[model samples]
Target: MENVLSSLIPPHGGKLVYRVLQSAPGKSHLDSLAKIRLDQNKQMDLEQIAVGTYSPIEGFMGEEDFRSVINTMRLADGTVWPLPIVLDVSVETADQLAIGEVVGLSDEQDEVMALLHLEEKFCFDKEETVIKLYGTDSLDHPGVRMIYEMQPVLLGGQVDLIRGRKSETRAYELTPKQLRRLFDDRGWSSVLGFHTRNIPHKGHEFIQLKALEDENCDGLLVQPVVGKKKSGDFKPEYIIKSYEKMIENFYPREMVVLAAFSTFSRYAGPREALFTALCRKNFGCSHFIVGRDHTGVGNYYDPYASHRIFDQFPDLGLKIVKFDEIFYSKKLNQYVQGNSLFPEDENDTLRMISGTQARAMLLRGESPPVWFMRPEISSVVLDSVRSGIQVFEG
Candidate 1:
């Protein structure tokens, strides 16, 4: 069959970025990385670049690209990029390497992961980065706290993945290349991408099904981020299992594809939403769903800020499907758009369960109502909680 994806939107910047090395480096080159190792977060960044998930971003941002992204949400060459993808390093580490030098990137076990061809080593204003990207300087936000805790120096270079890390949730991990191929094989010309860091609630499913119907898309890609998240958030294992159960019991199997992306959440609200949409574009998603408070944390961002961000960027490669806050109408006994009204109610009687409320209910051995979430999903969450799994506390 002809590839249906031939008509799908192309990757951002008109190319899919893949930086994995074609051949292994010599032993002498590997010996140089003996003392330098990257943290888990940086390793995840490298993995994204290698798999073309962060397409159009071949490696860490240079000083020019970093400043451009922070100040104007664009790359140095004027590509629409919302987040700064920089490899941070300590002052001592920066002092050891010179510009144009290549250094090996390794994990905690001293396993060589990638090789960084250094172009520039610069220092960034942490406060500026926090304010620009996250819209807050307060350490109360997890994204802000993470930026404050990063090393003082930033390393900019094109990275070549020497060895890739194995994902714990390997079965659900699909790279951009693989997703594009799958979409082609399935004869899906228009695929809608839905990104989430939380378990599937009724409101989420409602939006997904609504988008699929409204856009008349051929398929839906449910991609969840399976990386380090704040406390009280759902664990990766529970997330995968819950999603698997939800898809099996609820969504049409052939119409939906469940996958996971390995990347840390910055929780930058509007900016993260745009960043996510661009990433999804690289994954061959023609349309992206941007709901209220997408990638938000606490009360830092306005509820509809994510939708507004997309409105501001008109040329974003993928079409954005904006959704208003959806809630379950007790009077109608079904999910309804928040702006819509039920004839039986004079006052707004729409109800929606927040993540905190759902988590608390599950912890207290209460199952969320069918209108809120599937019992199958709740069972997996409750089982994990009972087994003493670490959840995002925030």
Candidate 2:
């Protein structure tokens, strides 16, 4: 249906990166190479890179790009890439690897997912990278813990996909090119992108609608993180189902698109926020919402740190629409943004129920109030619990 490419926004660094193999390789060919099995994070990143979601980054990062990203939030060529996308392998695998050779990148099931054309193999100071990229070397931080637990060696090269992954929510798991063409066919030239991990809350709904209205965008892209998340977070299936309920009943039928972002959370804070902006830009988003504490984990980063970082990088091409902290006001019986306390606002107190709290209530078979969460959405969550579905990641 997409006869022509979307004319909305050009991908970061010019063109979209698609390094997947067009045809399948024979069994004898794949079985001969050394295999490097990928972890959950690397497995997801491989597909995103191949599909152009992580556009302009064809394969994993080499020493130069990896060092440049960790030290200076930019690629080796001075592109505005904020995060590292490198593959890690054990010491034994690293020893057997040779420069300019090819290796099999397989999943945990030993299925060869792609073939990596080995370009660079190197190592760096792990602690320095952890401190610089995550802003702290504390293992208590999830991002820092991930870095410390990684393999000692990093591999950088391009990948040619042999077999692509299928999603649990297959119907809504659309790729960048599909989304771009969908937006173009809808005659929407200005689409806004919103990234989230939690199920819908009143505050989330308010911010989504307000951002769309304020920016005067033509459509909205709601990309819920659907891959690996920290323990106690909403499981991928439940989040997708709850969102499906919201979009079908509540959202404007023709003006919104719901898709699953099949990637793991780095909890990389502001840098990950920039990464989202770049990814969305490739999906034909004209603007992206930088909300309070976007992609933040715990109290490691400042609440408004993401909003401020966008200001320092003005050449991102994607326009950012910043929204302040939002909470529900009991007196007004509505959600309101901002935390500034006025004299009259003293009477209008705030009521906050986090995703964790909501999950606890649902696990107890008690529904959150209508003001906090819609009954329809709660029903989906409660049904998932009642049906013995794994509601939260462990």
By lDDT, the best candidate is 2
Candidate 1 lDDT tens digits, 37-62:
87777888888987788878888889
TM-score, cand. 1 vs. native: 0.93
Best by TM-score: 2
Indicate the worst ten consecutive residues by lDDT in candidate 1.
1-10
Model 2: how large is the Cα RMSD against the reference? 1.9
Clashes of each: 6, 0
Clashes of 1: 6
Per-candidate TM equals 0.93, 0.95
In angstroms, give how far residue 244 of model 2 lies from its true place: 1.7
Query: Model 1 off-target regions past 4 Å?
Result: 1-5, 33-35, 342-344, 384-394
RMSD of each: 2.5, 1.9
